[model samples]
Target: MRCAHCHEDNDLGLKPPPPKLQGVMRKGKMPSRAVATDQSVAQTVLAGKGKMPSFAGRFTEEQMRALIAYLRTDMPLPQQ
Candidate 1:
């Protein structure tokens, strides 16, 4: 998990870990308290928000789709 909120330890005295993202898609809350759609989440991942960095131009369309799918379910990651 590249997302620091989900994988990294806060041993360096950073803010506590972010909320778990297990049902963020179904609950419509992610990156913040605001509601978000799939398109919105993709946009956020691409454009970034707050401390999160943008991933624009970093992934192919298929990779982006696969990442989103993984976030929404337990699907395996698409091969590069």
Candidate 2:
């Protein structure tokens, strides 16, 4: 959630709030018009969605794993 586009507070009125990850993961809805999975979330991060920027080459697989794991735990993103 370090990315400005992913963090709602940082984005402000720039675009729609990035969907709530916990609910999206649990319910399979939001960011996209369909249900979400770890793989899909990773894809969204890598490819970008809506106003969110793409992180395609910015993170390693391990980093993506860490990010998904963190979201599944429903923990708040740490402050920079």
Candidate 3:
């Protein structure tokens, strides 16, 4: 797995930190939720918000979809 933003190849066993959103949770911080499918994730990636920058210009629609698919299965769950 690699970082979608940085493109650094992360070891398969290593887990990445969760994305935090201020004011979205009662505690003032929230972890990003999954989008259910690769396509949905790609759309969200293209239409970024908050701390997530849009990938519209950086990657094509097909590349975004591939990235999302990598995130869905290869990336580890957030730490507890």
Candidate 4:
């Protein structure tokens, strides 16, 4: 939850609130993006878009996969 905590924290006062991750993969697009694929989602996470900060150089491929997996689950994300 290290990386994801920020995405979930509503109290961060982020200029544009982060989008909740649940079902984002199923929806098949990144938030506020018109044309995005799973690869594109990964790219966005790595590169950032708009107000969301880039995660580039922070996550290993395995970690990124796990994060994506967690976001894909139909079940509620576990509290950290």
- Select the stronger candidate by lDDT from 1 and 2: 2
lDDT by residue (tens digit), candidate 2, 4-58: 3457355566555565555455566645675577888888889887777888899
Candidate 4 regions off by >4 Å? none
Give the count of colliding residue pairs in each prediction: 0, 2, 0, 0
The TM-score between candidate 4 and the true structure equals 0.76
Candidate 3 residue lDDT tens string, 1-80: 22322233223333553342222222322234543455555555677755456767878666666655545454543332
Clashing pairs for predicted structure model 4, backbone only: none
Model 3, residue 39: displacement in angstroms? 2.7
Assess every candidate by TM-score: 0.67, 0.74, 0.45, 0.76
lDDT of 4 by residue, 1-80 (tens): 65446667655677676777677767776567544455777788898878778889999999888777776774555567
**lDDT of candidate model 2 versus the reference:** 0.69
Cα lDDT listed for each candidate: 0.64, 0.69, 0.46, 0.71
lDDT of 1 by residue, 1-80 (tens): 45533324333344555444566776677858777677887888799877667889987889778667767883322322
| Pairs clashing within candidate 1 | none
Best by lDDT: 4
RMSD of each: 4.5, 2.4, 9.1, 2.1
- State the weakest 10-residue window (summed lDDT) of model 1: 4-13
